[model samples]
Target: MVDVAQHIRIFDQKPADELVPKRTAAIKDLASKLTGPKDVDGLMKMASNLVAAAKFDKKLPEELAQEATASIKKQSPAFVREGRDLELSTIALLAMLGAIDGGTKQGIIERLNFLSAGVWLGLSFQQPNKESRIEALRVEVLHAARDYVARGAENARERKAPALGAPLKPENTNLGEVVSNLRASVERLNRNAVVDREEIDFLWWSVTKWSSALDGLYDEASAYSAAIAFGLDGGARLRRMPLDVHKHLVLRRIRAAEPVSLAGLIAAVGDDRLRILTKIPDASTARTNPEIFPVMSSLLSGSAPKSASKDLQSVEAWTVRALLEATALGLINQHEV
Candidate 1:
């Protein structure tokens, strides 16, 4: 079996100085253009051009590439906040090229999250009405679900057989069963390449109904929390995670509301589990008290505890509950957080 974590480390390793001057010059030029309001579209085109250029040159380390992306997002929040698809798509394209060059599953999942977010954001910008927005979200959700199921199938194929005369561990056995079920679900989804409104309604029902079936097999809370963070962090992974696990995180984030930064989410959860899971830097830096958006105060006050504690279970529950509430209120679904 592939060691996903090890693969990520390999991709993260800094490359030796080769064409450093050229790469630096290219990045500096890109950064200069990214600073202006009108240059957002140009940046996106440049990102795509970079991807093509990367095909012939040595790919940048994942770390360097992601750093550049973060810088761009931070400098151009207006463009990102507006749900500019072209800009996001450019970021995804660059990441995709890096992942392809590196042959890392971690890279693939990262790319998918970016692609998925860009697609969803694009849909949101185009659909001005609530009903249309919901419809668009549902369609994308189905597509993401299908892609997840396909990935599960691939994982199933790669599963190694237990050593002869040795029984599989309980966790392994349970995972095997879950993968089997997932494969079966994919078979049903395959019958119709594009899921319609009626089909999506049925899927929603099925997901809710089968929620408990995977209880011991999956940690829904952790997955949901991670997704919230990923969404807030603009589809970037704060830490290393398997593609399969990260898929759940990103999908939930895509479905949930726009997340604040990691710091903001930690404050929202009002607990330590997320801090430990994502290794968040400092709570003091996070905007716990809502300023511009009073809705955030209402949401956090209702869900998060007033006092901080070491209770991880409460944190998980609070995060999941808060996200569900946000989803209902459509706070996390739209561009604004």
Candidate 2:
């Protein structure tokens, strides 16, 4: 396997402060050589050469220099291509300078890989066929949201435990800011109405659901690991799970006359039972958990409760109604009886 950590360090660690000017000058000299679009290939070659020069001039390790050269070769094409419309060339040059200065050559390359994919994917979805384009973008948005949520949950798990003398600080993942940014993006996208409204709505709803789930997980220490595992598993499942299966899940919730909040659903099944349902069972253990299986089956199959307290019932009703609206809006598909 590629040594990702080593690669990350190639760009992440900053160079000596006094050497910064020399690094900047070197990058600028290379950038100045690119006269036009046709010069992109030559410019990439020049960047590789610069890396080689830096190994000796800056006393950088030979391995780091080689990795940096590889990164420039791999990421320079995309930067050059995008530079046609935007100041991507300048941006790329500046990034390269920073990578060299910071010794994060591999990190810069990996980041550029993601950036290149995003740029091309965005352009692809901006085609004339609006319906198909919107659908494609929706899938991308879903995957992005899932990845963000799972990564956030995982990070929360890895947070260091406070010392005995220290007060235990709450886990602060900066999730609120992230959610705010997502909402702003959704609002901006909605203003032009370039994409399907239903697709945008679904994206917005997913963001809210994820934010709420993360908040709940952050507050409950005992449930954190289980919830994070469930979320990560669900995100993985979403990628390959059939569209029909998702429709079925949504349809089951929609069929309930009363609302069914996620909390209510959890309560009905019990947390331990819900946790078991989310878990992947080994072949030997799968059939042995007969009682646990029925709980999951019943939770999915049962209608909304009629006799719950007014407050709980209200929450349930709101939840179910939201699903109904989502189905009607085509955010969630309603399966025919």
Candidate 3:
């Protein structure tokens, strides 16, 4: 009586008519089997057992089946297939892996929250809440994504996203307050000379815009390097470029604060994949997202100049100059990871 095939279609959002009885029967069958407490642990078990049995009986592929098995160890393989596409499957896989590997429910929740931040960021851009803070973040992400897309050789049709960067000061953008990201974009414009602005003050501001964007670039570059400095081996994809990422990061961090070692950076940020780890926070005192990605992207875009090199000489140059400001504040400290 359980119309399993019809139920799959219904859950998957496939159009199905004339299967009311069948769908009802399938739902009843599922309800009958689920008789215990409906907590996360129980839910996980229920889904995992069902998916694991399917895997063994159906003999899924090594990679997929392996993921299925790992999911079973935590809660359920149903999660993998339940998602609309591979993206959700990827998220589910990570979640299940975390659950199995002794990650607490709280930790799992945090990871899940982290995953959802991008969604919220996108939504915030589309329709920000009353709070100007939310609007601020929306602008940052839109600006970042737009600038990155503009730099790529992709078509305008493929690259067009909604305009998101609101002027921090619509009436008057103080030279000191220009976001590093926008500054970099403007600089790229100047370097490329896409069009020349006649106004000298405007041109000067544009130069500054590019400079701030460079800072963002260095922020991200350093974060990625920080991840490398930590133990990320062949994990996240590296940028397709000729930039000396590590040296760039080292220099950038030194500039941000005084001369912190690789260990010190690891201490401050906790990882090098500043590119990914760098998230836009809720504008607390702490800078949440790694400061390097926006900056690195800017510096690397639109025929920008390259990094100094991978040599210690370049590293030393960064340490002395960039970190000079941080040293004044006593923020930089040498320590081991």
Off by over 4 Å in 3: 1-69, 72-115, 118-337
Return whichever of 1 and 3 wins on lDDT: 1
- Model 3, TM vs. native: 0.18
Would you estimate the TM-scores of all the predictions?
A: 0.22, 0.18, 0.18
Q: The CA-based lDDT of model 1 is what?
A: 0.32
RMSD, one per candidate, in order: 18.8, 23.6, 20.2
Model 2, span 53-152: residue lDDT tens: 2222233333333333333434343322221211222223343333323322221112222222222222221223233422332333334423432343
lDDT agreement with native, every candidate: 0.32, 0.31, 0.29
Model 1: per-residue Cα lDDT over 1-337, one tens digit each:
2122222222234533442333333334343432122322222233233332222233433433444555454544332323323333233333333322232222223333322222222222121224442233234433442343235334433423232233355768666766666666665454333223323443343233122212221234444344333332322212211234333443443333343533445554344242332322222111232221122332334343343223333233334333222221221122221
Candidate 1 has a TM-score of 0.22
In terms of lDDT, which candidate is stronger, 2 or 3? Answer: 2
User: Count of backbone clashes for each model?
Assistant: 3, 10, 27
On residues 1-337, what C-alpha lDDT tens digit does candidate 3 reach at each position? 2233432442244544533433333333333333232433333233332222221123333344444334343443243443333222222222322222331222112222221222222222132335343234334333432333222312211212233344667566653555665666665555334212222322343223112212243334553243222211111111111123322433333333344333333344433323322321111111211122212222123111233122222334323222221211111011111
**How many Å off is the CA of 11 in candidate 3?**
7.1
